[model samples]
Target: MIKKFLFSTLIALCSISAVNAQSKVKETNKLEDPDNLASQYFSQVMGVAVDATSNLKLYKFIYEWIGTPYRFGGNTQKGIDCSAFTKAIYDKVFNTTILRNSRDIFSMVNPLPKDELKEGDLVFFKIKSRSITHIGIYLGDNRFAHASSSRGVVISNLNEPYYSRYFYKGGRILDSVKDELIEE
Candidate 1:
């Protein structure tokens, strides 16, 4: 009777240990999954649904550049300007090159209405100028990523009073334009 009881207790302990180990492995895998981690981090940062961060390349690029100091005509990670940031994202995430300045970039896009804006579209702003002075990459949920002169690299909302007041238009680069740029 003693032997049987000890054997049964040993088996039970081993079974429990096996189950615990399996659960830990599953948790570790979930944590290690790059897509899962990116979705969670970007969803919180962008204030949007997790599914909205489906474009991992775009979000990861923005995430890595967040908090970079704003610089006029600067293009590197140490410092960058709004149009440069937009150009970098297009070149990296979308695999296309865009014009250097905000107004020139605006000319490359097909103008879109505010409500029609989609992820990866360009959101232009007048700011203090009569022409488009600032540009950002739209990240869905009315949020856009840009290098703000005041705030450095940050994600902002279209509905904010400052942005809403100056919001000029949203624009999407047409496939034909992308093809043309690629060929050049």
Candidate 2:
């Protein structure tokens, strides 16, 4: 009986030690994760280049400005149109210029199937006439971000009847190397 008690105690102590070691390892891992530090750095860089990041936030801000008013050839928080919105966003973010309109933007970016689309990618629509008519920023989960004339900055699902019918091509910008992108 004494031997059994000693063995049981030994096992208990070993299990306790193992649990403590695992807890320490988890804490160490939390500190070592690069994603944790990179997010802080990304916030600083994004602020400095607020006008030049990527597709999503630029369009996100544009969507916020929707219903401010639409003016011909205007580009500002006060007023903007389809082409103007697209041009202004790309110009501000990444400091690159996009093709003037829906058709041009559709043609400029690399073509990728809708199934392969991800966040910050461009979704083009073929409305009215063919040749691409509207553009939105893909938000993943089959939803996209865009500045609707009526709803302003909003997320729309691709499954929606209107969007599903007009959906055509998705544009993925492969310009930046993976190492070049600040993933945080």
Candidate 3:
């Protein structure tokens, strides 16, 4: 009985110390500049390496659309679908217009191998069926922003087990949206 009590007390103390240390680390690392804070937060969320030139507009759309509720065939902040969300992002950030459906966009662009994916490239997934059923914008460093059927708009790692398994291909819009491709 005494041994059990002592062990429980030790575990509780260790857990509290760990929580405190994590809070301290978070406090120390908090960014002051809004741009820097956004960049840092997105880098961590997307599992990407952010630099000075990281696209702020992309982050802008992601932050704006985050937590939107999913709705089939919808295209507004009140509710949105995956393809609609992708199209809106491209239209807003890149000034590029894309097809409103996942498969159409997949068919429209130059298909690329996963290894060749870059920021602004479209990442496609075949979640339920064999055809491309979902799409997201790649944000480099193996991260992509997508509107999930359940979770709405979110940034997720391509290497995540579920996404990795469903990932079909990456698509680049150089030819399709040549005039709108933002030259960096």
Estimate, for each residue in 1-184, the C-alpha lDDT of model 3 and write its tens digit. Answer: 9999999999999999999999988776665567788888867765677666888888778878989988998999999999999999888998787889999988779999999987889999998798989999998879888889989888889999999999999989857366545442
- Can you tell me which runs of candidate 1 are displaced by over 4 Å? 1-33, 182-184
Q: What's the CA error at residue 65 for candidate 3, in Å?
A: 0.8
Angstrom error at residue 56, model 1: 0.5
Query: Relative to the true structure, how large is the alpha-carbon lDDT of every model?
Result: 0.91, 0.65, 0.86
Give residue 184's lDDT in candidate 2 (0 to 100): 23
How many backbone clashes does every candidate have?
0, 4, 0
Off by more than 4 A, model 2: 1-74, 92-95, 174-184
Q: Any residue pairs clashing in model 3, and if so which?
A: none
Candidate structures ordered by lDDT, highest first: 1, 3, 2
Cα error of candidate 1 at position 149, Å: 0.4
| Root-mean-square deviation (CA) per prediction | 4.7, 8.2, 11.0
